[model samples]
Target: MAFNGKFELESQENFEELMKSLGLSDEVIEKYKDQGKIIEIAQNGNTFQARYNYGSKVITNDLPFGQESEFVSFTGHRVKALAKLEGENKLVITMEGLTAAMELSGDKMIETLTNGVSTVKKIWKRI
Candidate 1:
């Protein structure tokens, strides 16, 4: 899939539950509860870069496909993630204990995050 555009958050499912499962504090949860994020994905060959805003912070992750990359998680933990393309339209990223499966269909991007037990679905629309 060619993920080279900007996407705005359309909807998110089980957000609070997913945050709780990730061991986020109540205070932290309440702080960013209603805040939505906009993400920009830029891909060139096997190199990938994704930029997103978290609160007042702008986080960017740059990595290569099929390689291990370290990034700071939202919960303030350092974690490793391996990103790869699955088929023609799916982008899969495997993190510590979680997997993010992203698919681009038309002008919408659907991302499903699974942490073994709990799963959260987030949808973003092209901007």
Candidate 2:
């Protein structure tokens, strides 16, 4: 259950809706939908760091299990998040009004995000 790899987005469901619900501007959503994003993650023991890159812009987060820390949302908002490992390959994160889970199975990574109002699914492939 090693979470050290570069992942590229393969498909997204309700991405625009989720971005809009998260207060992202229409222009930003349009650009994101067209370009997509890449994520690189590294995990060491109980510590995790993830880098998200979209063209020239990049965001990084370092998360420790079960601890509250500041993390940047997709919309660039600094939010509080608590992350914990579920079993071997699933990483569950809870933020203010939102919950996200990322699971690595075989060669794919499946991520789900929910914020009460809407749910978004993002599928990624290892690179």
Candidate 3:
């Protein structure tokens, strides 16, 4: 089970930090300031969908969805980076292209996050 809600920070500093933590450069933030359009839509009047928008475009994970690596790992098309809530704020981080088990009952979402980033770094060769 996962708790899905819209998480936004109320501080300028923390808000910038949140974007930075998600891998956006300072300049990028400035350009996209107030340009980030996130929407949490409802499905079947019972489920929610969280998505980020830039201008008129929507960002997505592009990970492949398969059963083999579905649990205990994060991967696939339509797969996206992860956003987590830390000590005092909500953070958006790249899913690192890893698909780990959905930690439904854990506050330490970063644990699963690291796996994706680590795997991405290790498997990709610099060209």
Candidate 4:
């Protein structure tokens, strides 16, 4: 359970561009701009449960490695996703046109989300 911890967002890059590319409106993006994000992850074997707290919203997903599962997107849409572990520290998920990769290093977790047009990278520190 290397990813079992609560992590707080430390920094982000190109977040606004990624939101725009995902079809989110300016108003919606602005509302969440300065909000703090906390991610809680629990891993048991090849299955993982993750909870994302974004100020006013919370999203939880159950991911089973190497299997297709349903996960809610940031845009509030349910999508079919497949998740897999890369080596021992990285979890990569593919859904629709987006790819999300979460990697752990020391007490920090780096999350990269890409949708071809834009990419957002967020660094989270375990708390």
Clashing residue pairs in candidate 4 are: none
TM-scores, all candidates, are: 0.91, 0.90, 0.33, 0.91
| 62-97 per-residue lDDT for model 1 (tens digits) | 878999998666545778999999887898889987
Return the lDDT, model 1, position 91: 88
Instruction: Supply the TM-score for candidate 1.
Output: 0.91
Itemize residue pairs with steric clashes in candidate 1.
none
Per-residue lDDT for 14-38 in model 3, tens only?
A: 3345446656678876775555333
Per-residue CA lDDT of candidate 2, range 12-68, in tens? Answer: 899889878977789988977755468999987777788898677788999888899
Q: After superposition, how far is residue 69 of candidate 3 from its true place, in Å?
A: 9.5
Better of 2 and 4 by lDDT: 4
Q: lDDT for model 2, please.
A: 0.86
lDDT (Cα atoms) of all candidates against the true structure: 0.83, 0.86, 0.33, 0.88
Residue-level lDDT tens digits of model 4 in 28-94: 8998766757889998777888887776788899989999999986546899999998988998999
Q: Would you list the rank order by TM-score, best first? A: 1, 4, 2, 3
lDDT of 3 at 61: 31
